[model samples]
Target: MTLKICVAQLNYCVGDMPGNAQKIIDAARAAYADGARLLVTPELAICGYAAEDLFLRASFIEACDDAVNRVARELAGLKGLTVIVGTPTHGNTGRGDEAAGGLRTKSMAVQQRHNAARVLREGEVIATYAKRELPNYQVFDERRYFTPGQGICVFEAGEGESAVRVGLLICEDAWFEEPARLTKEAGAELLVVINASPFHVGKGNEREVMMQNRVRATGLPLIYAHLVGGQDEIVFEGRSFALQADATLAGRAPGFKENMFQAQVERAQAAIKIIATTEPERGDDAELWDALVLGVRDYLGKNGFPGAILGLSGGIDSALVLALAVDALGADKVRTVMMPSPYTADISWIDAREMAHRLQVRYDEISIVPEFDAFKASLAGEFKGLPEDTTEENIQARIRGVFLMALSNKFGSIVLTTGNKSEMATGYCTLYGDMAGGFAVIKDLLKT
Candidate 1:
């Protein structure tokens, strides 16, 4: 029996049980319509991953339970389909509570369900796989909430003589070597991994690399399902992929977009079939450009920032910053100023103005020629014995800092530093000169 599985890579809002349940219903219906007999969703797909303090609220927990039960009923009509979804199940109190206040009735609570997988067949839960490994390092606190599950579960899915055995795993379980080993040990022919992995720098490629190692270890066809969108400071890049046992990438979904994939499995050992992954769309500049745009849009929207401003120098770095800022925040919200020096080339001023006009960014020309003369006169006596040095150069930078800070203080706009990685790495940038800003767009960025 050849079984068709659909991996529904979805981005769910935390604490939205009703909305999430609807998504589940929609995805299941869509996948079923597309000839998928089995549908897999990410961890916390029903209630949203990492409900945080909301999990502490009894009302929220009850709402999730309600949603789960409703989903089971919604899925019941499909005779040949099975769904494996990750959710937080509430038991009465402890181990004995399974029979007490309505805890996990089935042997589902692995160690203690900090993480759980509900296996729904024909709309009713037939079995569940609790996550055994709990990550506790950066940004992970699962050890505080869930007890690790110990057992493994593999089920058959397909019609006719094509029944294919499959293993199910939550996000972290696929990363470590043990879980995949155990799943294969349990007689699973294929692997399904549902994840809510957070995004950071270089995370998209990192996930692909990690998945490659897992596929090689298990020697089984694998599917990686992930979430897309932003939650708070973290963003999820959805690059859902299917890989063959030989570590060949078959298909990959585009980054930051929602997609559904169908995987067909057979009884005989054949090379894994990839649904996509042929074309590399984004170029080097384009990827960085998109990343910058995404970072700016998400940062401002998430933190409730109103607008932004930047000092535009004729220098290459400042020009780059000005253009990137305009691209990110739009012309209406971006404002730029060219604080010209006597040494500033005439073409510098012309280029800055043209760029601003082209981008339609708000432009201001604040010349510091007179101000520099006034300062030179004031410090002339104190520097009587000293030769002209960078000390004098720093004074000019400080004066610009004071003015920009004042503008920011008055207008409620954030001052963005125009300095790039090169200047900051060597500390060639003055403290108040180019280093003045509310957020470092490239804090982790290296000059190289």
Candidate 2:
């Protein structure tokens, strides 16, 4: 017999409990309608990943719990449909005999938060798997919010011949050998890992390789459901995937986009097989481009910004920022101002205007020469004998900044800063000048 599983690669906004819960419920119903017996959502899909300080609040945890219950109740009517939803829960497991019943029991005294996944079926939570590994390095701060959970979660899906024993693991759990090893030892036939892993150039491939290692070690087919969309500065690329027991690529969803990725598993007495399409791998450039676009789109779109405005200097930094802005938020929503200084060449504004015309965005020229002259006149007495240095150059930049910010305040558009990583790291860019903006599109990228 064969069992179909669907991975919901969804974009969830942090702290949007109601919206996030609705997304999960909608995806569950759709996946159930699509003949998927099992559905898996990304980590913290109910409240969004890495909620930061929100996790520390008891009300936040309660809201997440309520959302999870809502999803379970909403999907209860879809009989035989099992959904594994990631959420943060307040509970601790009590010691119990695994052979008699389940491994988890509610402890009323302890109120520690756990990064957990719940198995929902027939309007009830059948099992819960708390993430064993809480990633602490780099972008992750899971250690600060959640208490590590012990024990393995292996539940049966379907019935009779088609039934498969599936193990549960959160993002960091699958990265370690112990978690998968214990789950396998607990009589699990398959592994489903839900994640909210942030995007970095080659992070997609890195995840697949790591999951493949887990597959090889345990001889169990695995499915990875990842979150997509930008949250603050971090972006989650949802290239959710599945792999065969032999470490073969069974299937993969697209990156930087939401998708219902399905994998059909055929269960036999001897072995289980996973059947799905393997999407073509994207190049590094394509991945990076998509990350930038999604980052900008979600940052503005989620935050309720009407559009973007940038000071187009006609240089590579501003030029790139303009292109990204236009691509992210259509040309009509993006506006560019060519703010030229006294030292600016004719080619600078000329090139800037030409590029803006090509992109068909609202383009305007506002020379900073007058403002620069005023600033010099004001500082003339203070710097009577001081030789000209970066201060003069910075004054021009700050003047341009004032113009862009004024337009931003007037039109309700966010200013997209164009400073690259190198300049920001070396303190080369003006603080109130070049750094005046709502978002930094290329803050992480180097000048080169």
Highest TM-score model number = 2
For candidate 2, the lDDT comes to: 0.90
Tens digits of per-residue lDDT for model 2, 297-356: 999999899999998877899889888888889999999998878879888878998889
Model 2 alpha-carbon miss at residue 214, Å: 0.7
Per residue, candidate 1 scores C-alpha lDDT tens digits across 167-193 of 888888988999999999999888888
Models, CA RMSD each: 5.7, 4.0
State every prediction's TM-score relative to the real structure.
0.72, 0.95
lDDT: which candidate is best?
A: 2
**What's the residue-level lDDT of 62 in candidate 2?**
96
